[model samples]
Target: MNVSLLLILLLVGAIVTYLAGDKLASKVALFFGLASLGCTIVLLNHYNLGENISFITRWITQPNVSFALKADGLSLAMVLLTTALTPIIIFSSFGNEYKNSKAFYALILFMSFAMTGTFLASDGLLYYIFWELALIPIYFIALIWGNGDAEDRKKAVVKFFIYTLAGSLFMLVAFVYLYLKAGSFLIEDLYKLNLSSSEQLWIFLAFFLAYAIKIPLIPFHTWQANVYQKAPTVGTMLLSGIMLKMGLYSVIRWQLPLAPLAAKEYLPVLIGIGIAGVIYGSIVALRQKDLKKLLAYSSLAHVGLISAGTYTLTLDGLRGSVLQMIAHGFVVVGLFFVAEIIFRRYETRTIAEMGGIRAQTPKFTSLFLLLVLASVALPTTFNFVGEFTVLYSLSQINVWFAVLGGTTIILGAYYMLKMFQYTMLGETNKRIFADVTANEGITLVLIVAVLFFFGLYPKPIIDLITPSLEEILTQINRIN
Candidate 1:
């Protein structure tokens, strides 16, 4: 079968999984996820470094739009990440018995389809459609399955939905404006259209609001902590691990190249906000009692640095941001999964409530320790490689920015260590707790292996993204 056909089949399988009932839903979802991974490997095998794979059939003639999908190195990388993680996420949720398991699995599979579409979409309208489509399942997943005060969860979901949709409306306006001026909604065409500085500024702001809300950069991020804390483990995993990347990815794909001059001129202000988010997020995390909430704030800090690195518009900065996105996805998902394990054992997410767990669950403690270290970006972890490159790139733009941004490492270490010391070290809490289950252990171990494997040898990911980053940089450089 053609590769594109396989992609369509994966979506079809998701629907079928939904109808298959509880016993078979997980099995079907797992099969589709593995098949998607298989397709990704096939794509990797056929991938050409210098060329993109395009599959398009005209959808509308008047607007000059087509049902277009294409994969470059960057898109392919994201696709692989999506495929690789979806199965793990699906499997990770097996421990929780949901009232509607079939619907739950269906939503997960559907989310995978939407995310894959987001990465492959070449048309601006199509990208936005998929972008919005991706949020629906997650919203439902969090709304129906989330923990915390029932009323609070509902409020968090609504706030998240409203905040994201509001930001995206601005992006839609930006897209429509580009379509009006450029006479097409194709991303490549938008890239080629030359706009006056005034037009660029307005367009840039519109796009910035959309992506910033998704990245949830400070002030705009008011909704994220509540949402993450209320969300189910699987919901949090999808949100942090992949959904957040959509915003960061757009910053590179749309904002930077579309308005190069605006990006260059506003880079400093952007970097300053990124620095503030880093400090603010870390400080906030330091005070968070709920482990999930702490990780949520920590995620904000990490992505802030990524946003700053992206604005630098240097080759290393771009490369680092992309790499960091991948690394953070894996690390954060793993961290949340570990949190889920603790919650399962102790029936609580409070850090103070968890004590002396290391004695009872040595294996769980060991894996948790490694994940915490990865979160803090210890050497030979993927986070270290990404942070080092991002900071190096930032230094070229401004030493102070680098200095401010580098505090993430210090702050990261402080929070992660504090959590670790409280949870795993010292006296054993006399309360009864189960050791890590086989399934939980396998999931975490797999994630940690990937983190270390990529950390020690980031050359492969860097090599994959470099050509595409260079292509994007070339376009930006042409403006000046």
Candidate 2:
């Protein structure tokens, strides 16, 4: 089977669900999500060793871009993450009642469609189209269904849309230049282009504006927390869980390999910015009173380390970046879902307003605690494996750099534990705290199980991603 089916299912599912009316929208979306995931798993499992999952068709003439969807080892892992998480993201929202269920579910599926296409597109211009396509559904989702003041929500979402799209404008510029130079929008064609140092620098900076803003590194991060805090839980999950990874994935796939010399030249600056984000995000998180806002900053800090690992240009760093990307995706989704659960009960985001959650809902407390520990990169959690490797990669770059970047581990624990203590461990709330519902319990359990299973044995992921990473490195080395 080809990779195109996976995306076709999501796009078709969106339209089908939109037509199904409110009664069956969520179910249709969930079914389609699962079908895509199931199909992906089967395709991945049945493939002979070294065989690629790919399909290419003529889609354009002037730009010479083809409808090429190829899932190499790297893309497969990303697609797997996107598909697997889509069902979970949808299922996590089953308990909530949106105003228009059909429309909301359709946006989610459309998002899945754009995101899957983002991962699978082997054509650079096609990838850019998919990249921009992802922003639309999310923009509508956040604007229409989000919580908070209408004007404030508009401000936040507009800022988010404009900020990300502005960054992407520069990226589009870079792609147009690459197409002009390479004469094709194919990934390999762009990769084969040999530009002068000046050209690489401009292209790298253009690409950097897009990815760094998406990753929301340091100074470019002003849009992140506000957007996360304003968006619905589902929107936040889509943004954090996989959308952010699009930026990181682009670094490996587009930035570093395309502008190898520029990336190497800017290594110190990028690592510094990444570490600054860790420190900056952690400090802000400690001061956050809103649970969603806190989680948003926490994401900033965690991804900072992953960003640092990525820019290091070492094998350990690259692999660790992917591993951490996966780990953070799951953990952030669980954490934000917890925030939603609490909001459903309390109707508040202020942490000070929450206390003694555990005294009432012991099941939720336990699950929340496990997720917190996992976020802090506690031992035997997948987060630990990812964090440790990323930090080790940093250490290889510079011991002091690792020391600075490593502060997130300490700072994360401090804020997360502080958050837990204030929110979950204080005097019991007067309101009735019901135990975990079946759907919520199942979601949390599944999340924890993955964090556990992978924490112990990350060999499969490591092995799966190593060959692709090696090829990327070889590409970089050849450029060198």
Best by TM-score: 2
- For candidate 2, the TM-score is 0.99
Alpha-carbon deviation at 117 in model 2, angstroms: 0.8
Give lDDT tens digits, candidate 1, residues 106-173: 89988988888888888999999989999999999999999978899999999999999999999999
lDDT of 2: 0.91
lDDT of 2 by residue, 1-480 (tens): 777878888899999989998989989999999998998887677553556668999998986989998777777788888988899999999889988889999999999899889988889888999999999999999999888999999999999999999999999999899999988989888888888888999999999999999987989999999889889999999999999999999989889988989988989999999999999999999999999999999999999999999999999999999999999999999999999999988899899999988889888999999999999999999999989999999999899999999999999999999999999998998877778799999999999989988999999888878888999998887777
Best by lDDT: 2
Query: How well does candidate 2 score on lDDT at residue 309?
Result: 93
What lDDT does candidate 1 reach at residue 201? 91
Which residue segments of model 2 deviate by more than 4 Å?
none
Candidate 1: regions farther than 4 A off: 1-3, 49-52
Which residue pairs in candidate 2 have backbone atoms (N, alpha carbon, C) closer than 3 angstroms, thus clashing?
none
